[model samples]
Target: MKTLKIFSLAAVSVLLSTVIIAQSKTETFKVSGNCGMCKTKIEKAAKEAGAKEASWNAESKELTVTYKSSSTNAAKIQEKNSSSRV
Candidate 1:
């Protein structure tokens, strides 16, 4: 009986951890830009909008964004960047 209880607890812990992991997501998107200033603006705006992490590469024109799904979404981050003209 004790071993069965331990197994059940372990299974519950794994399920909870999976749910927590699913709540945060990282996504990449292409953003239009020309210089270093653009990269700075893009990344900063994303974070200000509740992104946990943001990075923009000028040459590649790709922005990597990480945020909590419960708090924000990828579309919101993109919108923020575009509105800022980043």
Candidate 2:
């Protein structure tokens, strides 16, 4: 009975961790910019806003940012880029 209880507790812990991970997601946004220097500034701000990764496609004006949803979101990420030294 003790071993069964331990196993059940372990399973519950695993399930909770999985739920937490599933709730965290990456989001993207479109940001306007002109040059390479502007791109650097915008990307930097995204990192400061908790984005684990950030990339800008100048041709499309789309910024692809990967951040944990628990830490950041699409609207907030755009705000960061908009306030950069561009």
Candidate 3:
């Protein structure tokens, strides 16, 4: 019973750590653009900047991105957009 409790606690700790890590590493920000073409360009730029997932909304002009913090950050993604002239 004690061993089972220890195992369950360990599992919960790992799960919580994963959630925290994922949330802390991901970020959302705005990228300037105007249409479907803009969405395509922005998302492509984000991906090129090392994001694991890049989604842009034309209506809101918001980009939601997920990336490894060790590899990339929000600034890098936005910089890609600005540099690409997209």
Candidate 4:
């Protein structure tokens, strides 16, 4: 009886964890810009938009972002990210 209860609790925990992880989405896209200033701007925008992780490679012009899909998406990220060079 006690063992069965423990197993049920473990199962519930796993299910809950799975649900939470499933809700978080990750995506990468190409963005146009240059220099350290552009990198700062891109990363900040993504983090503010609820991205768990964001990296921009200036040489490649690629931005990799991991975020909660429920809170944001690729298009929104790009729109918020694309802005002035100065």
Candidate 5:
């Protein structure tokens, strides 16, 4: 009975820890940009908005960003990117 109680407590602790952890989210979206300079600006804006990683493709006009949901969201990144455009 004591061992059973300990196991249950341990399980609860693990579950709680998992719930408390922040999750990373990756999102890809279209961002209009004309050249390499635009790619740099777009990526920089995403990073400034708390993105862990940001990549922009000039040809495809796509931006992919990874960020923690606890700190920032895709909308915020997109807003920043749009405002940074030339």
Candidate 6:
């Protein structure tokens, strides 16, 4: 019985940790841009919109962002990037 209780507690702890870790999310999508300046602007806007990490590829025109889901989401980041002058 004691061993079973410990196992249950351990399982719960692991589940809680997984839930916490899942709050951080990563997303990638295409973003139109032409130059290094556009990359800078797009990345900056994503960060301003609560992205923890932002990378824009000039050749691929793709932006990959990592952020806390509790603080922000992919749509918000995309909206901010779209409104920016890039």
TM-score of each: 0.73, 0.70, 0.70, 0.67, 0.76, 0.75
By lDDT, the candidates rank as 6, 5, 1, 3, 4, 2
Which residue pairs in candidate 2 have backbone atoms (N, alpha carbon, C) closer than 3 angstroms, thus clashing? none
lDDT of 4 by residue, 1-86 (tens): 99999999999999988788668777889987789988998888878767888999999999999887767888878777764233
Q: Per-residue alpha-carbon lDDT of model 1 for 1-86, expressed as tens digits?
A: 99999999999999998789668899999988888888888889999888999999888999999999878999999888878772
Model 6 lDDT-worst window of ten: 77-86
Name model 3 segments beyond 4 Å from true.
1-24
lDDT of 6 at 34: 91
* Full-model lDDT for every candidate: 0.89, 0.81, 0.86, 0.83, 0.90, 0.93
Better of 4 and 5 by lDDT: 5
For residues 26-57, write the lDDT of model 2, one tens digit per residue. Answer: 66667888789878888888889888899987
Better of 1 and 5 by lDDT: 5
**RMSD to true structure for each model, in Å:** 3.8, 3.6, 4.4, 4.8, 3.3, 3.5
- Model 3 TM-score (2 dp): 0.70
Using lDDT as the measure, the top candidate is 6
**Model 1 reaches what TM-score against the true structure?**
0.73
Error of 5 at 23 (Å): 0.9
Candidate 3's residue-wise lDDT over 1-86, tens digit each? 99999999999999988776665366778888888888888899999999999999887888999898767889989999999972
Lowest-scoring 10 consecutive residues by lDDT in candidate 2?
Answer: 21-30
Flag clash pairs in model 3.
Answer: none
**What lDDT is reached at residue 9 by model 1?**
100
Could you tell me the lDDT of residue 68 within candidate 3?
A: 80
Between candidates 1 and 6, the TM-score winner: 6
